[model samples]
Target: MPAVSDLTSHIGYLLRMVSNAVSQEFARKVADEGVTVAEWAMLRSLYGGDGIAPSALAGKMGMTKGAISKLAERLLDKGLIERTGNPGDMRGHSLSLSPMGAKKVPVLAGLADENDATFFSVLSGEEQDRLRGLLHMLIDKSGLSTMPVD
Candidate 1:
């Protein structure tokens, strides 16, 4: 193998490291809010849209139905979300944020914005846009439609 240089470490590895760090921080910040990162993701998905079937929500979040079910149960227990029988599909249910859940979504979104600013504000506006473009390109090139939290 050729001698490794600083650049030889590859963008993928660097992106993964940065991603993991940011995710960890977000998880820690949200833990006390009575939701995991996964749950928050689901809540965010349901924030503005009309009710969505659990399976559809799972697909949107790139998670398994089982995982979505578990998170939904937790959200239900916390009174942050509710499940209603789907009128079109008797065997299926749709999820939406309860009034409380709807209320919390914006708060959580604000926190997310704050977190991003805190961590990424060092980058200039152009740099941030460039980074987002590059990351999107990498995702497209890598065929990564979903990211696993685990």
Candidate 2:
């Protein structure tokens, strides 16, 4: 009789195992920068853009409006972001990074680079490129555009 397929043999299991490891390590590294992984995602998404409403950011980040408001408030408390009335809509407000956040983004981005390098250094350059291509292909195929924060 054939043996039953094991969880370890599944691609999703393997991918998730690696993902959890990479994410946990990255989270630890970024914690020293005074940012959680979710915060990093939100901050990075807001980095290059103008002020955006919480509802708009919610759509962009694949999160809820309430969650965006909570994050905005936390970042505001940290002095990392500022919120102002939306010029286009009186009912909504727009959010953007503060000068301090703008300065910290590059530093946090460098940490991300270093984390990737450290974790994937075992792979050859060709292997790295191939892995990236495969992942991007999978992402495209799955229509997954959300920035993984959780």
Candidate 3:
């Protein structure tokens, strides 16, 4: 007889199950705010400060420059972000969150916090902390620096 493994027995399968549930729920929550998960990530990144170059933003998000430009266009259309041009450099530009975007960051952040709490409510505080620590350890071990926006 040959040996076979159950689909549920794989660690990746388990991780994917949990990840999908968490991400889907978060996506829905943010969608209600008229922003996709990726847009939320961009907004959150820009929340730190303004005048971030598209290339720099792409690097920080671990995405391609083209992807950043696309996202910027979407955000600009939504009136959530604005583009700034350099005086000396005609082609040089940067992105910053608009007034509305700045106000929405905290609201979206609250939703994120609530979603996480609701989803992980089954775990104790200590358990949640331990889980996060373990996940961080795994991320570091695997050299995974890209932000999970999808």
Candidate 4:
């Protein structure tokens, strides 16, 4: 008979457990501000830019074009983002944050900082830096550029 592996002994399982806790906590906090993590990612991506192509934003976020379009529509409905015809490509539109979105970005970012601090308060600054570095190293080694969103 083959031996049965214990899931609790796996590093990936431990990582997922912690990741879920952190992400869920952040999700709740951001929901209080009327957005999902995905929406937050979209807003953050558009914060400082002049306009970017939908395809570009999608690529940067590691999301599909359809997902980007849906997020864009929601932002447009909220008047947080505006779409303008692409100068170089008439068939395409560039998306940019509206003034309202520009104002909200900082507030949302502050919430994000608070959420992270709340969850990671147990860790010292050095520990936090180390954890981040390790995670970045893993991401680089694995070639994992996908944005975490739900």
lDDT of each: 0.84, 0.91, 0.95, 0.91
Per-residue CA lDDT of candidate 4, range 1-150, in tens?
999889999999989998898889889888888888898899999989999999999999999999999999988998889999977888989999999989988988998899889888899999999999999999999999889887
- In TM-score terms, candidate 2 sits at 0.92
What TM-score does model 3 achieve against the real structure? 0.96
How displaced is residue 98 in candidate 2, in Å?
0.2
Residue 37 lDDT, candidate 3, scale 0-100 = 94
**What lDDT score is found at residue 119 in candidate 4?**
81
Model 2 agreement with the true structure over 1-150: per-residue lDDT tens digits: 988999999999999999998999999988999988899889998998888888889999988888888888889999999999966778878899999999989999999999899889999999999999999999999999777887
- Which candidate comes out best when scored by lDDT? 3
Best-fitting candidate, scored by TM-score? 3
Arrange candidates, best lDDT first.
3, 4, 2, 1
Tens digits of per-residue lDDT, candidate 1, 85-129, equal: 977878988899999999988887877787888889999999999
Q: List the residue pairs that clash in candidate 4.
A: none
**Clash counts for all predictions:** 0, 0, 0, 0
- Model 1 scores worst on lDDT over the 10 consecutive residues at 3-12
lDDT, candidate 3, 28-104, per-residue tens: 99999999999999999999695798999999999999989989999999999999998888999999999999999
Error of 3 at 67 (Å): 0.6
lDDT-better candidate, 1 vs 4: 4
The residue ranges of model 2 lying beyond 4 angstroms of the native Cα positions read: none
